[model samples]
Target: MTNVLVCIKRVPETSGQILLSQDGQSIDARHVGYTLSAHDECAVEQAIQIARSTDGEATVLTVGNDDSLEQIRNALAVGCTAAVLVEADTENFGPADVAAAIADAVRSRETDATTYDLILVGNDAADTGDFQVGVRLAYALGRPVLTGIGTVEVQDGTVVARGKGPEGTEVFELSLPAVIAVQEGGVEPRYPSIPGRMKAKRTPVDMVTASVSPVGNGRAALRLPPSQPSVVEVLGEGPAAATAVVDLLYKLGVAT
Candidate 1:
């Protein structure tokens, strides 16, 4: 059986305009909605699939405040068998801090004889676009890590991962007890059923205090790029616009 742990982050939904805080230190999330990153969602689904196939268990973990518990419960509702919440002031937590906290939690579980056979995370943070956590976590745990992986499978105590490379698809095999940073588009995450949500509500979450101090990422401030102005062009009118549309499509290389 292969036990898996999936780490996720609650990020602001990017469908709407993203604004920075007045101090420019962080995102202004007061008016924004939050959800799991696409990559993290896929990673959670992969962990669930792996656990189900191996008749093991999948656990979800996150380093954040109480608001993060909603995300943990969502993962549990879909399929994760267990959940962990590492309480910390995530506003000041950087990639290194998150990795350290996760490493500490993993070590704590190891001390209790709860060994995870595989760990999964998003290739990068959706909000910050930082790509260091998985690699740093692997280094801290002394485990091999693969990033930007799209698919993962376990066989013979090893993980076979496939991802897109510069030329095309590339595959790698790594020993068990490894870390994988997943990208989106590998698998579709399942929606939580009503019963699943109810069951998840009753599942207990293991709460742990972050052992590391918050160290902000070395960015002085954040700046948003200037918005591009929109332009609208009107073709002719009625059937007369058909020729213009065809010509425009051909000019844009959309038509032969």
Candidate 2:
């Protein structure tokens, strides 16, 4: 059976205005909600699909503190058969640090005879936009890796990945035991059902302590872009605006 491991990160939901912390080292998430990135959710869905089709197991993993349990349970509710948490304070953990922690966890699992045929991760982090984790993780494990993949499938002993290239869709094939960084839009992530949620609540998460030292991303501060200015011009009010509308459409070359 093909055992798949999907790596995810807990990121602040950006549905509202994002505030930075006083130290400017991270986002101010005290008042905001948290969720997985779109790419990570898609990767989890893909892993579940692959595992289900192969009669295998899909395990979800994350490097974060206890608060990340919610996100892990969400993945379990969808279809991941197992879950792992690398207990660590991710606030100051850069891409290299995160990658090292995950690699350690994977090696620990291997020691116990639990080997993953494929490891999936998001193409880039939603909060930091760090696109180096998957590549770094692959390097640490001595495995081939592909990034920006939208679709992936396993056949025989090969994994096929497809993504958008400069010209058109590009496809690559790698042997088993590889890493793939997934992008969104390849598959629709399924929502958790009531029963699934209940079942997930009972599933115990396996925890591992991160052994690597945190070398924070060399960022002095975080800055938000200036808001764009908006200007509105009222055209007309009621039926009296018919003439103005026709003229505007004609000037835009949409009228015959």
Candidate 3:
């Protein structure tokens, strides 16, 4: 019997209207209503695929506040067995600190002598898009990691992963109890059907680490930038405009 644990993050929905902080650091999550991140959604879909393929159990684990329960239900609606939430609400909680907290959580599981065959995570959260957590956690866990993987499968304690290399597509076969980060496209994300949603709503979610001590604390103040002048606009005759545009693009190193 193989058990799979997927670690996911609730991230902000990037509506075009939203902008980053003025200092060019941190997001204005004030507008960031939580949602499953794109790559993390792919992680959930991959979990479902593996769970179906092997007929095993897959559980979702996340870190956030009460606002994150909806996202957990979203995961359950897709077909995950259950969910666990770790509330590590802090501002100073850098990637390393988050990784440490996850390591502590994994150790708690280890205390029971319970071990998962595979652990899945998004390559990065959309908000920070740091592309760090998966790798960081893997490092903390002292496990091998396959990063930027688009397609992945687990079979008998091994991971068969597809990633893009400089030349083209690269495939990896790594031993299990390992970590794998899902790429943007990867597998198709699943939506909880009406029935699935109903079941998920009825399903109970366990909240562990209720008062997770945050490693990073404090929100960086945020403000929008003053509107900038238009970068591009079309005008004048079509034929000459096309030629001029092409010439300008080439000159600007935009096109050849």
Top candidate when judged by TM-score against the true structure: 1
Span of 10 residues, lowest total lDDT, candidate 3: 210-219
The local distance difference test score of model 2 is: 0.94
Cα-based lDDT at residue 230, candidate 3: 90
lDDT leaderboard ranking: 2, 1, 3
Ranking, TM-score, top scorer first:
1, 2, 3
Q: Each model's RMSD to truth, in Å?
A: 2.1, 2.3, 3.5
Off by over 4 Å in 2: 234-256
lDDT of the structure predicted as candidate 1: 0.93
Better of 2 and 3 by TM-score: 2
Residue-level lDDT of model 2, residues 193-239, one tens digit each, is: 99999989999999999699878888888987887777766789999
Candidate 1 runs further than 4 Å off = 236-240, 246-256
Candidate 3 backbone overlaps, count: 7
How does each model score on TM-score?
0.92, 0.91, 0.83
